[model samples]
Target: MVGLNRLSLIATLGAVSAQFQKPLLSQLDDVLLETDKTGDKPLVDTESLQAHISTESLFEHANALYELAKSSEQEFGHPTRVIGSEGHRRTLEYVAAKIDSLGDYYKSSTQAFPAVMGQVFQSRLVLGHSVPESASPMSLTPPTTGKEPVYGNLVLVDNEGCGASDYPDKLKGEIAFIKRGTCPFGTKSDFAGRAGAIAAVVFNSNPDGLSGTLGTPTPYHVPTFGLSGKDAEPIVEKLKAGEVVDSIAFIDSVVNTINTTNIIAQTVEGDQENCVMLGAHSDSVGEGPGINDDGSGSLTLLEVATHLTKFSVKNCVRFAWWAGEEEGLLGSDYYVASLPEEENKKIRLFMDYDMMGSPNFAYQVYNATNVANPTGSEQLRNLYVDWYESKGLNYTFIPFDGRSDYDAFIRNGIPGGGIATGAEGIKTEEEEAMFGGKAGDWYDPCYHQLCDDVGNVNATAWLVNTQLVAHSVATFAASFEGFPERETTKAAGVYEKDTLYHGRYLVR
Candidate 1:
């Protein structure tokens, strides 16, 4: 990882250059005109456009679907696997319904009982208070019945404060106020519980409200809740003044099994010997409608698949809409791991799209090492960045972190890449000046919350990012070199030999 000083210096220089540029739409027009003059298809031909939807059209379709999802009270609470709740089944059914409506354009598949987990937040029975209108008990929170009025001083635990053997003892009987950092929420809660803390409160470290799963359930026992910084400020002040505080925590949340589906659409215009896979998870965390979490990517790919089938492309383009991603990439990991080795090797590239609609998000490129950069991955990133720069779009490059579905591919050395909009972190002063959001605010505050409904999407950002993804898919399908094949029997034999040697010598 690059040091903060270096990163800041680069960003400062980049920001200065980013300001003196033309509009992106104007640059797109120029590129389209040039491509047209070079004998490429015109951008606005009815027949051609119909044959393949433009990126803008795809964004519109995504917005429509997002609206459909948002308006359906039935579609709300479609939580899958995380808490094993009925909401999971509802989410599955909703996705399956969408795929079914697409007719023969898609094929459906499932991976059963994928290992999925998330954080827990319980209500202290004694501390049971009236439920806030906006907040609910976090999924996996333990059940409580006691109603004791627990009071203690609030202690702020930083990233380094967790996990010490004596640390929990220090906070015993006190209310531990922790910052969201380093470890998952589960770890912090577990630590507090072991130390005899009465209750726990967590707040977002950044300007944006803390969102996203904590990845696992904490084994230790305690009541927990996430509070916005605004809600926590007064509590922090009261603690400083040595004021004894009293509050109730009401947790009535339950967990059960729910069904969700993975939507797979295919275009078989060319030889089916090898396939190019493009995927994005369709499910969102229960907090919000997920218009941007994946609505942007899903809609873009849906439009791409819809149009590609109308053309005579040489390779197959399979679009997969996964489920249970917020529960730790469950759908894609299950699907990929279950595939036979022979079938797995047939995949050329896995293009994943998670978030591509945050107007304030920086444009990022995944830096994959060891494995060669496939035909259009690097080109796609550069093309989008250059396109953004030419049009003077304020964008930044974030280092690759395997936090999405792309992890499945990278683990197996399958070449892959995609795009994302910013999440729950503030844009710096430099970024704010270059971009258009407040410096202290996150790119999207509604991320993973109920506020992330259809209305939260940024249409312009959705349009441009979707177009970039569409363009990359189209170009890669037209010209991807085949992947090198590994002989299974020989590979297995080599593996066996290595294992035997290690067992015979290393173990002894």
Candidate 2:
């Protein structure tokens, strides 16, 4: 009844608005004419689509997304486009508006679902009398707020706190101070708890404040918090010098189910049975405005989709702005699971784009040539490799370690590949020589932090990756000439689960 009433209301509003405005269908003809380079609509080609990608348009959309995320904090008290937040809703609206502007050229809709999300309202870490402003709680870690804040003398854990031996006997009934590296956050938290520590504080190896996770909830975990390198340095020094550092760690976090939507759009003029899909997670972590982590990828797809409106395609091209990615790739996982088997066969390939403009960037393509990759994945990988080699650009291979939106596709026997600049992984001296970025620094220092704002992105790297994305979309949409067919059963491949969960990369 509510749905019917909403539809009726929409109809009434449409009728009222029709009096002052031209019908959308009527305006589409004029829009089409404006988009056409020739007098007639030409078959979509690689060069024509590539020509449409511009730094001006990319940044224009990027800036809009960034501003929307910023405004979300003021309007809704959430500083990010996290799933189910108003910021995410506004982001969906932005994408929908862009698709709507195409006016019948594409079909679009929102895929709504419920997800359990852990929201941290407050995470405070106090060392002696000094409180660190960069302190935050790891998502899914046990919370200590509302109860007495865990108070104890801090014991510096030797090494990276991945092993039980690292937690000294002195950690018993104390707070364990450990550096963030080698194994998942959960590993350290569990070790700290087992060592009888009241709480665990993990500091980043990089200068940025760490916004991370324990992968998932565990009974062995204790209240855990993160601190930036600079903030933790003094505490570390005091503890190493055999000085007793009194500390308090508090976290107020809760997990609850919330409704979220994924925005999906596809061309109407192509063979739907053979579709080429491209996706990027639209949701951000709860830490900050996720403009670069995925805003770059999401906006890149949006810009490409806008340009594709000017031409026709042989295979349908679908663009998805996925939600709930930071909360364990929930949106894409749901999408793939809910898709019917016959509809699943329609997807020729899946390409994902995430964090394209990391400050210290690299041209890293998915390593689909590895034995663990599903059938047809290698060919898709070759497209990116060939594109880079053709342009005489330096490139490297990134593992398909179930890190991004591509996880669902490959697990379902669908061939998938994409590109990323880099994330929390440190840049080596070799990468420094190749990419001309600082060695021993994070590719994205602001990865999953409050600093992942407008200034965090590298515009030059973003533009290059955006063009590469456009090139792939045009190539597959034109023809899947050399692409292999997906198998009937789930693809046989070992998905190497890396220590990198979401944007946080653990050393192990």
Candidate 3:
């Protein structure tokens, strides 16, 4: 029950509740608007909530989550805190416990999902049918292994190997050398394999011979190698010269079925019809602890939710710690699909945060207000813009192109927006001048690698982004009156996946 004194104070003031000092009360009255139609829950505007948010509190919460992930890694002896792993399980429990400690102010629960989890991968391309040389693995359909390398004669498959006719009958029991082009690596590789080649080698379309992704997985393709064009030309020329040389191509990877849960928590006292949803992925990639990839995001939300209990909310604020995001945004997708129509309709807007703190950082705000955005998305974008402008910080806009978990919500027409530092994307000199990071370097050089542990986070970046998260949540929970109404129809031309991503991040 709420304190009798607090109720009496609100009754007397007509719009206040917290044990505020004179200055805070004066500040609250100036901004907190009148109650909604029910008049049972009054507004607790952004200013009042921002007053409670401290950089110190954010770091405390962030460090807490990092410690949990590190503990999970040390305890489990695994390189990552991926979904269904022991560390991931403990991390989920920690988040649940934090939510529970809010004393029933927020109702919390776990939503579970079963997924075909792909773990680590190992690949090799042997030379002279003996010692193997280094080669990159393509994203889609990494070969299932334990089969010995196929020592096949090499065949030059030109025209991007996009068609069966691209590979001649002479390709039987041979390794098809294809060029990357308009189609996906998976398609090219699959076509070559179907044409009777035992293996496929995709050389670069660019001068440097950049590695490529198959885009999606397929069972038809055999072991594939993504080699630079430079590294592959000699062999190609040799094969063309009718030099009878045999090569061995091999790959080893693991695919397993795993169970994980998405943690959902919401304010018990707010209006159920107009819910404000916020989320971040809780699972990490297999290569590292993923502290920056998402621990920064999930913990930031946790801190906001924990502090929110100190005040009242007019609209419900729901928090989610999604699992299996690194793999394919699986947990968020599952949750969205499971919601009843009415339940889905209740979600007014969703704001997501992923990879908000990279050691080499720049602020990246989602372009949710732009073309193809859902209704109310613009308001969320404006909120961040207004917030950043207030601080005189420069932030770049990243396309809301379904690169993250928000895809599931927005595709169903729920308006959403969020912040990110960056992933594997390279930073420009312009960004360097604005945010002071190295130009031409990846925003997160350690992204998806073994170094993305607690040490990978940029402290200043995390705090600033997290504080903005608090301000946004407080603004909506107070009243979403200024935001536009949401449309129930599925969004048209929503962010679709590239053939390579397929709604999941291509963990290159």
Taking all chains together, each candidate's TM-score versus the true structure is 0.61, 0.73, 0.82
Better of 1 and 2 by TM-score: 2
Q: Residue 340 of candidate 3: its Cα lDDT?
A: 80
lDDT scores for all predictions?
A: 0.56, 0.82, 0.76
Question: Which residue runs of candidate 1 sit more than 4 Å off their true CA positions?
Answer: 1-51, 54-67, 70-139, 145-214, 218-252, 269-273, 359-361, 367-394, 432-440, 449-451, 482-508
lDDT by residue (272-346, candidate 1, tens digit) is 556668887777665556777776677766666655544445556677877777766767766766667767666
Model 1 TM-score (2 dp): 0.61
Clashing pairs in 2: 182-507
Question: Between candidates 1 and 3, which one is better according to TM-score?
Answer: 3
Any residue pairs clashing in model 3, and if so which?
A: 186-214, 215-500
User: What is the C-alpha local distance difference test score of candidate 1?
Assistant: 0.56
Q: Residue 313's C-alpha lDDT in candidate 2?
A: 82
| Ranked candidates (lDDT, high to low) | 2, 3, 1
Per residue, candidate 3 scores C-alpha lDDT tens digits across 148-253 of: 5567777888677777788898887888878767676778877877887788877775556455445445667766777776677677778778887677777776
Compose the digit string of candidate 2's lDDT tens values, residues 409-439.
8777788889999988899999999999999
Residue 17 error, candidate 3, Å:
26
